[model samples]
Target: MKLIDITNNHPKLVNEQLSNTDAQMVKVYSLGQTTVIYTIAPTHKDLVIINPKRPIRDNEIDYVLQRTIKAPLQSLEVTHVGNFVEITQSLKKKRPTFVPRFS
Candidate 1:
């Protein structure tokens, strides 16, 4: 689903919006060429995010966020790129395999 494009221009407003709604922003990253995503933590209700303070569909997207999470995911895309080979290649890195354990 499309997320309210609240990129990190104004943190205070975003915090207030999330706090007032009792929602927490878990992460903010790009999904692909144009798609910026905002992943939210589980809460009593759906999230209502602050509008982006500035333009997010620009070159600053640095697009790529394909981790796993357990909650509703929202996205916004620029939808102009035809080739994602470079984008995929750039984000492709071997991550250290670390499994966490609790005592």
Candidate 2:
């Protein structure tokens, strides 16, 4: 996915993009590296999440599963809904143990 494409097609992602909060480092799997994207929360400022490494492939998804089982960060799916792109974290399964939980 190209940055221009994302920006043009999915304005929501770019509009909601945010900088990393908290000093702690978070490990996330690459979805499709093109550029950064963002989302708007009901409350608080927009949140930005990193795009998966460029050229998302089956192998990359496999690598994410393998590594995540060992160490996981919250996983989110980026999808386009009509004219807007939405970023949603999957609740299908538990996040990796290494992932920090908010109290």
Best by TM-score: 1
- For 1-103, candidate 1 gives per-residue lDDT tens digits of 2333435755775677677854466334333323343434443222121223433332233323223222222332223343221111111336789999999
User: Against the correct fold, how does model 1 do in TM-score?
Assistant: 0.27
- lDDT of candidate 1? 0.36
By summed lDDT, the worst window of 10 consecutive residues in model 2 runs over 21-30
Write model 2 residue lDDT over 1-103, tens digit each, in one string: 2222244665343333434432122222224552333333333222133334334343433344343332232354544333233344433445667967899
Off by over 4 Å in 1: 1-7, 10-13, 31-35, 44-66, 70-103
User: lDDT of candidate 2 vs native?
Assistant: 0.36
What C-alpha lDDT, on a 0 to 100 scale, does residue 86 get in candidate 1?
17
Question: When superposed on Cα atoms, how far off is each prediction in RMSD?
Answer: 12.8, 11.9
* lDDT, residue 82, model 1: 32
Off-target runs (Cα >4 Å) in candidate 2 are: 1-24, 28-54, 69-103
Per-candidate clashes come to 0, 9
Q: After superposition, how far is residue 48 of candidate 1 from its true place, in Å?
A: 11
**Which pairs clash in the backbone of model 1?**
none
